[model samples]
Target chain A: MRISMDLELQDRPGQLKHVLTPISDLGGNIASIVHHHDKKTFRNTVPVSVIFDIEEQTLEELQEGLEKNGVAIVRIGKMRLRARTHILLIGHIIHTNLRETIDEIDGTGFAEVQDLSLSMPAIDGPSSAVITIMATGDEELKKSIGILRQIAERKDLLFIEPLDERGSPGGVSNEE
Target chain B: MRNSQSTLTLSIIGFGAVGQGVATIVQNVPHIKVVAIADSKGVARMPDLNDVLARKRGGQPIANSNLTALDVIRTIDHDVVVEVTPTNIQGGEPGLTHVREALKNKRNVVTSNKGPLVAAFDELTQLAYTNGVALRYEATVGGAMPIVNLIRDTLAGARVLDIRGVLNGTCNYILTRMAEEALDYDQVLSEAQDMGIAEADPTYDVAGIDTACKVIILANAFFGRHATFADVDVTGIDRITQDALQLARQRGFAVKLVGDVQELTVSPKLIPIAHPLNVSGTLNAASILTDTAGEITVAGKGAGSIETASAILSDVLSLMRDRT
Candidate 1:
C-alpha cells in the first residue's frame, strides 16, 4: 500500500537522514518528501511530509518503530480506511447513552468516532454534540452513517448527517 | 542567588513528601520562592521556608493561616502554584480543582499528581492554553524520568507514533525482586512495604492502576487522545508467579508491567531481557516510537521526593523561560 505520513522533525543536522533510515529498514520504498523548511510548527518544529509504500501488515510495526526512535508521526496518510467526516447530534446527548453510541461505531473498526465536542446549555435542556468519524471509503462511511442513524432513531436524538454534492438546506460538513 | 527581577513567587499545595521535596530544593534556587505551603490540616503562608522545612523535618506542625491553599492562590501574589497532592482516581479531587484554579487565576502550574490529568486532561490542557499559562506535570508518569519534557521539549518535532514504558516504580521494584531473588509475590510485597517502596495497601501499584494512569496521561499528552483509566486494559503483576518469571528468564525474556499507548494496555508482558524496557529495581523507562527517529528510550528513577521535585523544578524553569 502507498502511504504518506506528515512528520514533524527537529531542525538539526542529520535529523531527516535519521528518519528515513527506518522506512528502508522496514522494507518500504520512498516516493517523495515535501520538506517545509520555511515554515515551523507552533511547537517550533519543522514539518516534513514523507510518502512511501510497504506491505499492509508491516504498517503497524513501522509506526511503532518510528515512535520508539523519538520520531513524531504527526499525521499518517490514509492510516485508517478512507478519511474522516464530522456529524452533529442534537438533543439530550448526555441523557442518552452517549458512551455506548460512540463505542458501537468505534467497535466496527471500519469507522471510529475520533473527536467529539458537546455543548450542554442547561440541566433540563437538550445537548448538542459534534462527533468526527473516520471510515475507509465512501461506502463504509455511508454504512457507518446508516448504523448511526438507526442509533439516533432508537434514542430519539436528531442525527444531522453529512451533506452530499447536492448540498441540502440543513447540511453537515463532509470533511472527506 | 536571588534574581528579584525575575523572581517567581511560588506556592505549594499538599505539603506531602513530594511537595516538601520541591520546597527544600527551591530554597537554594534563585528564580523561585515558596510563598505558601499547605497540608491537609491547613495552609501556612510564607512562614520562613527554612522554618517550615525544619518543622516538617522535625515532625512539628507549622502554624496554619486563616486561608486555605485555594484561597491563598486567589488572594496571594504568587506567579506559580506547585501541586503535589495525593492521587484520587475517582473524581480527581483537590488536585483537579487546585490545578484548575491556578490556571484560571493566570498562574503557571507544575504538578506531580496523575489523578487530575487522568480525569480531565483535555479540559485542563485547553484551560491552560486559554489562560496563557504553563500547566506542567513532568513527575506524573515516570516520576523523575523526564518523560513529559522529553517529548514536549527535547523531541519537539518528532511525531510520536506511540509510547511504551514501565512507569510505576513500585511494580518495577516488585517484578525486579521476583526475577532476581526467585522471590514470591507476597514475599516481595512485604519486603517492599518494609522498605517503604510499596504502600501498605499496594492496590494502586500492584493491580496496575498506577501504570494504567500513566499510560492514559501519555495518551492524552502525546497522542492528543482523551483517554481515561477505564480505557486502559490493565493486568497487574500480582498474578505473576515465580515459575512464570523463571520460565521467561529461561526463554531470554523478563516479565514486566509494560504500559503501551498504542495498545492502550497496562499489563504484565514478556519483554526481551535485552530490551530497554527491561530496567530492573526501582528504575523506570519509556520508549517512544516515531517515524523519523525509530525508537528513543529513556530510563531513570521513577519516584522519590527529591527526584520528583527535580522534575517540577525544571518545569518551573521552563515556565520562566517562556515568559522571557
Candidate 2:
C-alpha cells in the first residue's frame, strides 16, 4: 500500500506543505518526506521524494487528486502490480494532455502509470516522455500498450512498443 | 426431475406462422420466455433505426423495417435465437446472416431453415464449436420424428445401408389417395392443398425436391458425410396415375413418392411391396435400413404446425440439458 513518488517541488518550506496537503487530504498516510534542493547541486527547483501508505482504491484517488492539483509525477512505485512496463510516449507530449493519455491506460483495467521520465524541450509546448506502468500480468501489460497503440493510431503520437517483446503472454522475461 | 426452472431468454427471427408455432412451445417449455421477435415487417423490441438493411453475398439485401433482430439481441440479451424464416436456398442470405451474427455475439441458435443447413452447415457448425455452443435443427427433417437424432446417436455404431421413406406428407397423402379411393393424382393433390398440407405452389413437395433436401439433411447427420441436395437422385410421384395406382393395388402395394437413398447410385422406382402403408393415409412413415436391426420403420404424424413446433422444443430441451 506504500506509494513512492519523486516530484519537483518549489524550493520553499511551506511549498512542501502545498504538495503534501492535496495527497494528505486525499486520505493517504504520509510515512516520510525528503527534499533535495540546491540550484548549484541539481537544477533550479528541488526534487522531493514522498513515501506514504494508502488503501488500493485511495491510491488511485490520490493519484487522480494529485494530478488534478498539477502534481508532476517523476516516479511512483507500488507492490500491487507484480510486473512493470516501460513505454516511450512520443509526440506533442508537453501538450501532453495527461488526462486523456492516462485514461487510455486506466481504461484497460490492467495497468497504471507508475513512473514518468519526461523531457521538455521548451517551457511552452511539445515534449517527449517515457512511462513505466505497473500491471498485474504480462498480458495486462500488453493490453495497456495495446490501448496506447489505439491512441497512437488515432493521434499524431508515436507509441514505441517495448523492446521487451514478449514472445508469449504469461512468460515473464528473465532479462532484469 | 423438475422439468421446469426459469425462463429461457429467446430471440426469434421471422415472426411468421412457423415462428408463432415455436413461440407457443417456448411458453409451454416448463419455464421459458420469448424475449424478442423479429420479422421483415417490424421487430418487437425497443425501437431503434427505422430500417436496417445489409447486402449479403450473391443476394439482394434483406430489409428490416424496424428494430433488427441483432438490436433485440443486444438490448434484451437473449440466450438463444429461433430462426424460422423462409429460406434462401441458393444464396442463404438473411437467415444465415442473422445466425452468424447471433453466434458471434454469443447466443445459441435452433432453426429449421433448410437453406442454412443445406449451404452453411459447415460454417455454422464450426462457429458453434468455437463458441462452445449448440445449434440444432430437429424440425429441419422428419418434423417431430427423432430420425436424425436416432441415427446419429442411437444407431451410431451400426452401419446404415439406406433411408427410404414417405418424407413429404403432402406427396404421401396424394399418392395414398391415388392408391386407395381410385382417385387421380391431380384430384388428390387439390384435396391435399385444400387441407393446408400442400403449398399453393406445391413444386417442392410434389416434384420430390423437398424429399431430396430432407434426405441430404439425413445423410449429413446419419453418415457424417456432406451430400448436397443436388446429389440425391430424385423422382416425384406426380407421374403416378390412376392406372398405375390400380395396378399397384392389384399387386398388393402402394405408390408413394418415397424418397429413397442408399449406398449405390440409385433411382426412385415403383418398388413393389407388401408394406401396410396402404392403410396409413395423411401420415408419415420413415424406415432406416441398418445392419443390426434390418429395416426399422417408424411412422407417425410428421408435419403440422404443432408437431413441427414440438420437434423444435425437443431440440431446445436437448440443448439446454447438454449445456448444464
Candidate 3:
C-alpha cells in the first residue's frame, strides 16, 4: 500500500536522513520527500512530507521506529487513486442516466469519478460530457475504463478516450 | 536521375488526380516514360503527355486505344504499373485485378489505392514475393508521408513497436476547424466540402473507414498482422461536438482522429496540444515507436494530387534503382 506521512524534523544536519533511513530499512520505497525549510512548525522543527509504498503489516514498526528516533509523526494516511485520466462522452449523456454511469466506475472500489463537465446544446439534441476518473493504479484505471466502455456501449453513447502521452494505449509499452 | 542509362516505362492504370499528378511529374523526368494511361472511360496508349493532360482538363476522355487496363497490363511491356485507382474497401475491385495481373506478369507494381491492399494484403504480398516483383504502396497511407518506406528502408534495423497518427487529412481538417473556430461538426464539414478538401460523400473519411484501411495496411506491412477493414475498432468524428472540443482545449488537448497500428483502432483521441501529433489543418502526422530509434515522427500533406504523386514517384524511382 502507498502511504503519505507528515514528519516534523529538527532543523539540524542529518535530521532528514535520520527519518529516511528508517523508511529504507523497513523495505519502503520512498516516492517523494518534500522538505519545508522555510515553513517550520510552531515547535521550531522543519515539517517534511514523505510518501512511500510499503507493506501494510510494516506500518506499525515504521511508526515505532520513527517515534524511537524522536521524529514527530504529524499525520499518516494511505494514498489511494494514484492514476488518473479524463474521458469524453457524447450523445444523450444525461438522458441515459449519468448518475448510473458514474456509479459504475465509483462502485469499482478501486476507481472513482473525480470531476465532470457537461454541455447540452439543445433540449432535444445530444449532450457532451467530460469525466475525470481516478484509480488506485494503472491496472485499476484500465479496468475502470473497460467498465465505462461497456456502459457507454449499452447506453449508445460515443466514448472518446485520451491517447496516453506514453505513445501507446493503456499507458503500457512493449519496450524491451 | 542516377538511373538515366535506360528509360523506365510505366503504365499509369488510374487517370484520376493521382494519375495526372504522376504524368505531370513524369514529363520533366527523362528516365521515366508513361506508356499508357487509363481512366474509367478508356485507355490512352503511347499517347502525348501534354495532349492527355489537356484533354483531361477539358473534361474529355483520353481513349485512343481499344485496350482496357487489364489488356494493357497483359500486352504492354512495362517495368512498373502505377495503380492510383479509387479505393473500394468492400471488394477491392478494378485495382485488385490490375495489381494481380501486373504482378503475375512479373512486373513491379506501385499503387496509391488501399482497397486491394486491405482486401488481400497477404495474397498480394505473397504473390509479389513469389513472382520476384516488388509491390510498393507508399501513397496508400498518409499520402506523401514516408511511413511504409521509412520503416522498410531507412529504419530497417530498428524494430517498429507501434504507430499512431492522424491518417486522414479531411477528418483532421474538420476537427481542427471545429476546435479552432468553435464551430459544430456539420458546419466545418460543409466548409471542408466547399473547399474541395473533402469529397461530396465524406463518409469514408469522416466515418473513420479511410483511417481504418490505412491501419490495416500498416498492421499488415509492419506488424505482419493479416488485418482487414473489419479487424479495426473504428469510431468516426461525426458525433464529436464543439462543446467537447472546447472542453478538451481547456484541458490542453486537441481532439484528433488518430489511427493506432498496434491496437488496430481508428478513433477520435485526445492529443496533448503540445504533442507532435497535434498537427492542425490538412496535415498528417505519424509517431513511430521503435526499439533502437525510440520515437520518430514525420508529418506532411496527407492528401493532395502532387503530394500523393510524390510518394508514388519515389516508389517508382525505388523500383528503378533496384533494377540498376
Candidate 4:
C-alpha cells in the first residue's frame, strides 16, 4: 500500500539520513521526499514529508525504529484517492435531485465526490455546478465519470468534462 | 519555385469569399494564370482577375462564357483546378462533382471546401489515386492553420496517435466572449453575429456540425478511419451557461468547444486555463499527439477570406513545385 508520513527532524546534519535509514532498512521504497526547511516548528525541528510503499505489517516496526532514532512522527495517512477529475453540470440540478446524482457516484465506494460548487442565477433558471471526484485509481475514476455521464444524460443536464493535459479524454492530472 | 519557362494555368470554381480571396492572391503570383472563374450564377472563362473581383464586388454575375463549371472542368486545358466552393455537407455537391471531374481529367485539385471531403472522402481520394492525380484540400479543416500538411510533411514518419482541438472559430469566439465578460450565450451570440464573426443563421457553427465535418476529414486523412458526419458524437455550445463558465473560471479552467479527431467526438470540454488548446477569441489551436515527436501544438487564425486563401495558395504552390 502507498503511505504518506510527516516527520519532524532535528536541524543537525545527519537528521535526514537518520530518518531515511530505517525506512530503507525496513524494505520500504521511497516515492518522494519533501523537506520543509523554511517552515520549522516552534521546537526548532524541521518538518519533512515522505511518501513510500511498504508491506502493511512492516509499517509499525519502521515507526518504532524512527521513534527510537529521535524522529517525531507527526502524521501518517494511506493515499487512497490517487486519481481525481473535475466535471461541470449545467441544468436544473437541484430540481433533478442533486443528492441522488451524488449518491450514485459515492455509492461506488471506490470513488467519491470530493468538492462541489453550485451557481444558481434565479429560482426558475438553470443551475451550474462543478464537482470534483476522487478515486482510488485511473480506471475507477473513468468508471465513475461514465456513471456520472449516464446520470447527466438521464437528468437532461449538460455535462462538461475536462480534457486531459494531453487534450485527450480522461481524468485531469493533479499536478496540472 | 515557379517554372519560368511556362505558366501553370488553373481555374477558380466558386467565386465566394474564399474564391475571391484566391483571385486576389493569384494576381500577384506571376506564374499561375487564372483561366476560368465560376459562381452560382455562371462561369467566366479565360477571365481577367481585376474585372472578376470588381464584378463580384458590384454584385454582378461573372458569366462571360457559355461553358458551365463542369464544362470548364471538362474542356479547359488547365494544369490545376482551385475549387473554393461553399461546403455542402448533405451531398458534397458541386464541390464533389468539380473535384471528381478535375481528378478524373488528370488535373490536380486544391479546394477549401469541407462538404465534398466529409461526404465522400474515400471515394474522392480513391478516384484521385486511380487517375494518378493529386487531390489536396489543406484549407478544408482549419483555415490558414497548416494542420493537414503539417502532419503530412513536417511531422513525417511520426506515428500520429490522436488529434484534438478548437476547430470552429465562431464557437471559440462566442465562448471566449461569454467567459471573459460573464455574459449569457444568447447575448454573446448576438454580439458575434453583429460583428460578422458568426453567421446570421448560426446553427451550423453553434450546433457543432462544422467542427464535426472537420473532425471527419482529419479522422479519414490521419487515423485511416473511414468515418462520416453520422459517426461523430456531437454536443454544441449553445446550452452552456454563463454561470458554468464563471464557475469553471474560478477553478483555473476555460470552457471551449473541443473536437476530438480520433474519437470522432465534438463537445464543450473544460480546458485548463494555461493549456495550449485553451486559446481564446476566434483563434483555433490543435494539439497533435504522436509517438515519435511527442505532442506538438499549432494555433492561428481559423477563418477569414485571405487566411483561408493562404492555405489554398500553399496547396497550389506545392502542386506546382511537385510537377516542376
Q: In candidate 4, what are the lDDT values of residues A1-176, reduced to their tens digit?
A: 56899999998898888788999998988989999999998999999999987766899999999999999999999887777889999999999999999999999987899999999999899999999998866677889999999999999999999885654543475421
Position B59, candidate 2: lDDT: 41
The best candidate by DockQ is 4
Ranking by TM-score: 3, 4, 1, 2
Second chain TM-score per prediction? 0.97, 0.85, 0.98, 0.98
- Give me the displacement of residue B147 in model 3, in angstroms: 1.0
Model 1 lDDT per residue over B71-190, tens place: 977878788889989999997998999999988988888999999999999999999999988889898988889889999878888888888888889999998999899887789999
lDDT of 3 by residue, A1-176 (tens): 67899989888888887788889998999888999999987789998999888877899999999999989999998888788788888899888999999888999888899999998999889898888888776677889989998999999998888886664443222210
Query: In candidate 3, which residue ranges exceed 4 Å CA deviation?
Result: A6-28, A33-49, A54-74, A167-176, B1-5
lDDT of 4 by residue, B1-324 (tens): 122446888899999899999999989997889989988888998898999899999998889978889998998788889998989888999899999999889888999999999989999999989988899988998899989999999999899999998999999999999999989999999999999999999999999999999999999999889999889999999999999999999988899999999899999998888788989899999999999899999999999999999999999999877876
TM-score of each: 0.65, 0.57, 0.89, 0.86
- List DockQ for all candidates: 0.01, 0.00, 0.49, 0.52
lDDT of 1 at A172: 24
Order the candidates by DockQ, highest first: 4, 3, 1, 2
Question: Each prediction's Cα lDDT score?
Answer: 0.80, 0.65, 0.90, 0.90
Worst 10 residues of 1 chain B by lDDT: B243-252
Q: lDDT of model 1 at residue B264?
A: 88
Steric clashes per prediction: 23, 2, 0, 0
Docking class of 2: incorrect
State, as a TM-score between 0 and 1, how close model 4 is to the true structure. Answer: 0.86
Residue B97 accuracy (lDDT) in model 4: 93
Q: Could you tell which candidate, 1 or 3, scores higher by lDDT?
A: 3
The reply for model 2, stretches above 4 Å from the true place, is A1-176, B1-6, B46-65, B73-76, B263-268, B271-273, B276-279
